[model samples]
Target: MPTVPRLACLLLVAVVAGCAGTDTSAPSASNEAETEYDAATVENMREGTYNDAFESSYEPLPATPTLIQDATIMTAAGEPLENGDLLMRGREVDTLGTDLPVPNGAQVVNGSGMYVTPGLIDSHSHLGVSATPQVGPHYDNNEVGMATPGLWMEHGVWPQGPGFARALAGGTTTALLLSGSGDLIEGRGFTAKLIPARTPQSMKFPDAPGTLKMACGENPKGGSGFPTTRMGTANGLRSTFLDAQDYRERWDAWLADPTGAPPERDLGMETLAQVLRGDMLVQVHCYRADDMTTIMEIAQEFAFDIRSFHHAVEAYKIRDRLAEADISASMWSNWWGFKMEAFDGIPENVPLVHAAGARAIVHSDDDLEIQRLHHEAAKALRAGREAGLDISRNEALRWITANPAWALGIQDRVGTLEPGKNADVVLWTGDPFSVYTKAQRVWMDGALVYDRTDPDRQPRSDFELGGPRQH
Candidate 1:
């Protein structure tokens, strides 16, 4: 079985690489100068503006031209405001009050009986990798090497992927593109805004910090033949971080003496160095309690941050510790029992984490589930309510909205509808918590991206290009 998973992953990477047209060579460094570089310079060496990553088809629409009024707005901050009005302009929120100026020629969307709020954000997702039923080469979420810290998930993204369309229509405006969980150190994941375009770059959230995906527990160790145990996963994660720490020090020493020359740049080490230097966020996948605790300890040892814990089914057991560490729990609502480690999962995990004052994020690990993230959030809220926790619908909405936005390190840009924030908003036919609720209209960067009534707003991937329009 382990060999089967490994072979599947290998074939997936090969297929994805072939479809991508060409493989970008990893940056090389000489061992002779593999020491003595400044921290800033070493950091600079790792960060480069890639023209390919920025390519996208999304265009921003007039911000001040759309007005949604007379709706109950769940701010995801405190309370729901009845008769609230949200005005957007040029990719940012211009106003969010009952009394607001309506610019001339603005598209006044009648929200008389609707609900409006921040667009949903999925902090943990493998949509671009394992999109739908198309397995094999279409799925390259994990790298083959155990030390593939240098791998970037964005490069593997199938821009024409149909998964993005479904997520956008389902009301998710932003998502963190993560590599698969086949490896302990999966690779780099970036926060992306779901905008229709020709490339992934066009879809990425501008200025969002890059994140590294790490895993602990069964996915990393218990997979038939690899680590084969919990302790093995811990060792892999710890060793990687430790190496990163060393890499940072070597580069720092070299930088102190520029004339001496810089150290050799190993792609893997360079990636880990970025984390040690706080240039990247750490996203870990773990389901069991002991594993989670082990991860926290490793993070402390290296003094690196763990941005969020994804698929944390047993998170409720350590709610206080998670809160104290300021770690966010990016979790599934009802997903569990599919594997042995996840057997202890309880639906109340999210609510319990939130009640303890820790950040709680709801994410779509599945393509179908990604479309209905709001419903998943609703389920989590219901579970909490059943557990006697004081959770409001508006607060629960944050699981898919503001909370995730924060976890992805893009809160400053698109999480909330505050002035100066990106105008990524969703309009629903009813309370999003209700199963009957559906997104009537969606906007990203003040541009109308999806509208239930507008056929053009509906996205069609390259794969479906020649196929008959489903409509």
Candidate 2:
């Protein structure tokens, strides 16, 4: 395996080469010097205007206008519709309503006794990085350093992972692949679409804001190190942010005038600076309520927002605080008591958060659970109803759809079945919350990526070919 520095150099080369189209030859001595000077100038540019060298190269698959008539639709943004008609025209939802006329040259599917919904989105996952048939070398979910924020999950993502196809078969259209919580500040996580591709860049979600995965509590405090205690954990995070602030200040001053020598670039601080500047979302892995409050206080001190807390088992205890802070709770339905910090988890955690007007999302942090996230949401809904909460099926559906999309900062593009949004639709054989139902057809950007009725349309990873579980 290549070292982190070597990987960064290769990524830079690829980005520069791709941007400067048709430049296949090496530059001469004078041209190389000029290129270095220009690179320095680009680096010192304004904060928000600085282009991401690793921007997504994803393009939706070609699709035609498709119409699914007479289905129960869960828009995830409003009440469920009965006998609704939805039309997908060229990667966008054209219309949705009762008895809508199908356009010319559109393929129509009879949806009698079926259900439709916006494709499920998992706010937390480790599919591509921690590839299936788990083994030592394939475990790319965590780095050796405890505070390596410079590392990006996209670098470790293997697009040929079989988990992508499993997720798509279970109706997951979009997912945020995160680093494990073994460290204080693990790395930058990335959002990806469940598209079978040869490279991670081809599966990246276009323009989705980057995510920084941080952690608190026992996971980070396990080893005998600097952050063996809760206080040490807090201090470590605070010190890192302070250092990033200084780095940002120095860069800003250098950008004011590019004539002089430029400051040395630190990859880790650059990522932290983006978080401080609100360009990237912060997703922390926190369990206990007190730890969650402490992290929120730290965020307040730094003036950076916490987007969501993963495995937030005790979030219900501070739902009001989370609501006020506008932090989302991405939690499991019934996972608890596996560790000391998770001992206080309750089945009604999501419901309590939702009742308090906080953003509540049902997330799957496990590889197998990610494929059945809809079922997890269904379990949470049942628990809430049994506890006397009047949560409807449509509202419960949002736990795995709109709520997770908002947490991933991609709600504007692919969360609801609204006109002009990406047509990421799932046709279910029955009510989505029902255990017996399966995703009959899954579409990403209006393209039919998975169809249970067609063996050829079902995607299979390269690893699965000629294996015992071949599709």
Candidate 3:
């Protein structure tokens, strides 16, 4: 059911905003006047001395202003608005309430009997790296060595893969596609906007903090290497952090006094140093409760923060401790007992963690699971309700949207349907909890990217032109 390639651009007015600057006063987009830079400054920029590159190149798909009326708007930040109107204008949400003044030439859609909510964000996914048509040639997720912190998952992503389109159709507007947990120190994971593009750079989320992928438990120990035992794995991790601490100190010394050339750049060591400086987010793959506790000890020893624990099936056992440490538990709704560490998983893992006052996130490491993240949350919500936890529908919705946004450190811009937030939204046919519901349309950055009714709007791959690709 793939649909279209990226269509031709349409001329539409967009209200742009200014990028966050270090200045005390935030400037607007209109105030971005061209400054005449000196020749020396231009030369420095050309030499890449000022800043890092690989910035976001995602532009809104060509679309006119859109207004939807008579729909239940799930703002996610607050209560749902019944029979409300949502206005998307110029790359931002204009307003969402009853009886809004529709701008001229705006396309008005009848959303009666439908529901609109903030676009879903998959906290964890492997759609792009381990793309569809799975085979030996397309496997780009895992690396050869155990320690690959310097490696970036985005570099290995195949943008033209059809999996992204299918994900978009399922209402996944954003995802943190990570490397598989085959290594101890996996790699740098990328938080990407799920838009079909020519390259990974075009899909990267702007200003998102870099994510460091580390793992504990069975997967790492199963490999035939130095870290084949739990003790060996823990010691190896501690040794890595100790080296990183020394690396951070040497860099600090060189920065304080530029006497000689800076210490020879160690890409892997530099990544670890950033973690030491609290610049990168540490997300670990640990299923067993004791392994998570060990990871917490390691974090304490190194003075780095653990943002979230991924695939932590046994997190419910230590929910209070996770809350005390302000760490999020990104777990699956029903995935249990696939391995030894994951054997203790329970159906109430998500809600129990949230009830204990910790950030509870539902993630999809599987491609098919990523397609219906809302339904996945519904499953957790039902289990919580059945167990007598007073969880609201909106609260359960946060598992996929807000909590994951917090985990990725992008909650300020997305995960909610606010006036100034990115207009990433999905139109659903019925209550999202209903198994019969389907995503009718999707928008990213206020651009119409997918429409179930229009073949020109739905995403299609070149490989789908002649025959079925997924089967």
Candidate topping lDDT: 2
TM-scores, all candidates, are 0.87, 0.89, 0.88
Q: Write the per-residue lDDT of candidate 2 for residues 381-427, one digit (tens) a residue.
A: 99999999999888888999998999999989888999999999999
Global local distance difference test of model 1: 0.81
Question: Per-residue lDDT tens digits of candidate 3, residues 1-471?
Answer: 232222211111123232232223535646665345555544333222244466678676776789999999998888899999999988888899998888998989899999999999988888778988788877898886667888888888888778888889989899998989888898888999998788898899987888899999888888877788899889989998888889888876755544434566677887888788787899999998999999999999989999999999999999999999999999999889877787889899999999999999999998888889989999999999889999988899899999999999899988989999989989999898889998999999888999999999988866557766575
Q: Which run of 10 residues does model 3 get worst, by summed lDDT?
A: 4-13
The RMSD of every model to the true structure, in order and in angstroms, is: 11.3, 9.7, 15.2
Angstrom error at residue 418, model 3: 0.8
Runs in model 2 with CA error above 4 Å?
Answer: 1-52, 467-471
**Best by the TM-score measure:** 2
**Tens digits of per-residue lDDT for model 1 on 184-261?**
887889677776566677776767888999887766674655577777777777777777788889876765566454
Q: What's the true lDDT of residue 246 in model 3? A: 95
